[model samples]
Target: DSNNDLNDSEQEMVDIEYMGNNNDTDSLGEYDDTEVNVAGNESDDNDKLSETFDSLDEEQLLFDNGDNDTDDDEFMDDWTTDVIQSDCEIVCEQNMILVVLKKCRGLISMIKRSTILTLYFDAQRKRFKKALNLCYDVKSRWNSTYCMVNSFIVLREIIENLFSNKHQLHITQQQVKKLTNFELTSADWHVLLVLFSILKPFYLVTTAMSGRQYPSIGLAYYLLARLRNFLQQHNKKESLLEKRLKQLLLKKFLNYFDDENEQMELIMLHAYFDPAGFAALTEIERRSVEQTIKKSVADQASHSSISVANTLSITTTTANSENKPNANRNVKRNAMNLFNEFVGDIQYGENRENESKRAAIINEFYQYRKYVIEFNEKHEPDAGSVIVFWRTYGETFSILKGIAKKMLSTPATSVPSESCFSTSSALARKERARLSGEHPCSSVFLKDKIKL
Candidate 1:
């Protein structure tokens, strides 16, 4: 919510009259007497913050507030985001949010605490006519940090003016007292740009896997592989500080991918059936998954062949087919074939018949393997899901399809279940607090369900 105080544009660059004015600094003197209007933080003060700002003219604030940078020693008269991004692409690109937060935090707090600052920026947004506000980091989400750092790079001019030397002169001495030591340096700005570039891939991966509208598992392994490659490729080119951060990040990533060994698989067994994910597998990994499906199919066939009906069917079908069609031809089966049929346990078979059934199952997997290999070679990267792929091809390889039905339905992440819990939590949080336990329980339980 504190994130709403953001504006980006140069279109109409209007003037906003300083609050109660002759001087912009004139309003800073009276801010303590007014309620703070920053991102939901309220103050019990003489008047509402908006009423004070709403009365001002926009065109005057643009020049009266610290926005005028013609004589500012730290920044150019006309610095743009293009130059900032070029610097962002080159500097020590670790997470710069922490640095900027540490360095300018006091000044930032000072700015946010002043309703006068909001009044000036709000008037600016109206003049420029832009929809998106600058991004402020939300601690609970990883991507929000990227958004915050990017906001810094994109809105450097605004930020520079807010902490510029003249900015301190224009504000009350009490507010500017501690902010003198926290101004942003050019190097700090570069770090911000570079950090934003580094976080781009992470932001993309988080967004790609965050789909609630679709099964995102199909892209799971594919995105992971690409993200891994990005870090490793950039690790070599990064500055010392960045290289260390990349290594630490890479290590943490591997922990997520290869975390469990004995019970759960990190490669996502479901991924092998996903067309996008299948393409990410190495030849060895492809064989490993293929072999696993083949084994399942073979095991299923082995058990089925041992059943009474299947044995009888196999015996009548494969044993000297010439004998089945009596009019066509009658040829006696070889003595070896006859002896092999009854060998070991006659009921359970332990015979060539059951082995042949399993062999047929394995043969089915081989055919599936061939089709899949060729399929991936020609597969478009962005289209199709595992469910659709198996659904379309399952009929041709019925045995393999059975295994795929169970394997491919596996969720790539816990987002689906988390979504359910999140809703319950939201419901409980809204009205159940400080109520009877059973009352809350019934309310939570029936939040979305019909009583009937």
Candidate 2:
């Protein structure tokens, strides 16, 4: 029995050992399979990466070529080409352009003649006649004689066509002579003079008459003067009108009038009548104007003294100056000094209890008044009736004052006229064949500043 039992146990041990060997073999096979799968995946990933790099290289070359072509196109489209072309073609083309312009002028003139006659015959059209007359007057003054003459001729043709007059509208020699002898006084001439001065450089009249911006002579004059003064003060020489308005026509329009506070009208009146005698005004004249502006500003300050005093008094008491000892003391001392200086001359309302507030307000008013006087002294307005002028017209004078202040305060140099002219030359490049057109030239000139 013992011998049999031993055999059974030994057999059991042998069976266990065999099972362990089988399990080891299976694990080894699985490990080998995993290693083969990993190697294959790594090889495929390397191939994909190489392909992506190749694609990227091709794309970069295509982009570089495209960039070079775009740069070349931009270079060819520059103003140099235009200027060169213009130089080559100007002499030949100018005469031809002049002829076309003259023909167009003639057509415009004829239309004006028919319109004028029609308006003159109708009472309701009297305003239109006045505007037309104003337009002619301005054209005669600022425009070249050739333009005026051609325009008149065209006007006559248009009128003749419209009227279908078999016989000419006869005007006796005496009537023509009487019309030629019509005279305007200095004051009567002031309005037209100002209007022309503002409109001529800007070319606003042409723009407005074409029915752009309602085409009011008065409104155009006002806007032109304002824009001109603004530009002049900023040292901006370019005009806005040239950029727009090529072939506008007035179908219907609204009339614009100068309001009492219109600043441009005032400035224009001053420019026309006073003529900015800065070059010619004696020291005494300048002093007198300075005194007048000072007095006016002082009067305004005096009127507000009471409110100023109350404000100062309240601020002094309510402010917690103690928290910052040094700052508080300094502020208090300054306030006291200012109070003492103005208290005697300026009166405050009795109901106001705060003395410090009142003093501060008075000081501030005085300071503002002083600034205004100083401004007037540096940039005096042209002599005119102040009541008739608009407050908006003061913008030019104010801008002039600001520029002067900056020049005086800082070491920066003023912009030279030559710089502006150079910009104009570059922008207006006469060489560009396209720049020959008046409207196109104007547009380019206006935008020249942006390039700078």
On the 0 to 100 scale, the lDDT of residue 359 in model 1 is 78
Task: Indicate which candidate wins on lDDT.
Answer: 1
Instruction: Please give the clash total of every predicted structure, in order.
Output: 12, 30
Candidate lDDT values, in order: 0.56, 0.34
Flag regions of model 2 displaced more than 4 Å. Answer: 1-265, 268-296, 299-311, 315-452
Weakest ten-residue segment in model 2 by summed lDDT:
245-254
Number of backbone clashes in candidate 2? 30
lDDT of 2 at 435: 41
C-alpha positional error of residue 1 in candidate 2 after TM-score superposition, expressed in Å: 99
Q: Write the per-residue lDDT of candidate 1 for residues 2-109, one digit (tens) a residue.
A: 223322232212221111222443333444444233344454331454455453333233323333431231212343433322334333433454657555433433
- How well is each residue in 1-452 modelled by candidate 2, as lDDT tens digits? 54344323322211101122334333343222111122246554335434433333332332334334422211122334312233443343334333443333333222222212222222212212211111121222224323333333323333323334212222223322322232223332333233334335435434332331231122333344444343334223433321111111010011122333464333332222122222233446444544444454445555577567778867865775645566556554577777877765444454243354445434543443454445446554422212112232334343233322332222111233445568789876755556457766565655557776
Q: Which regions of candidate 1 deviate over 4 angstroms?
A: 1-97, 103-109, 127-130, 134-140, 165-170, 235-241, 262-266, 298-354, 417-452
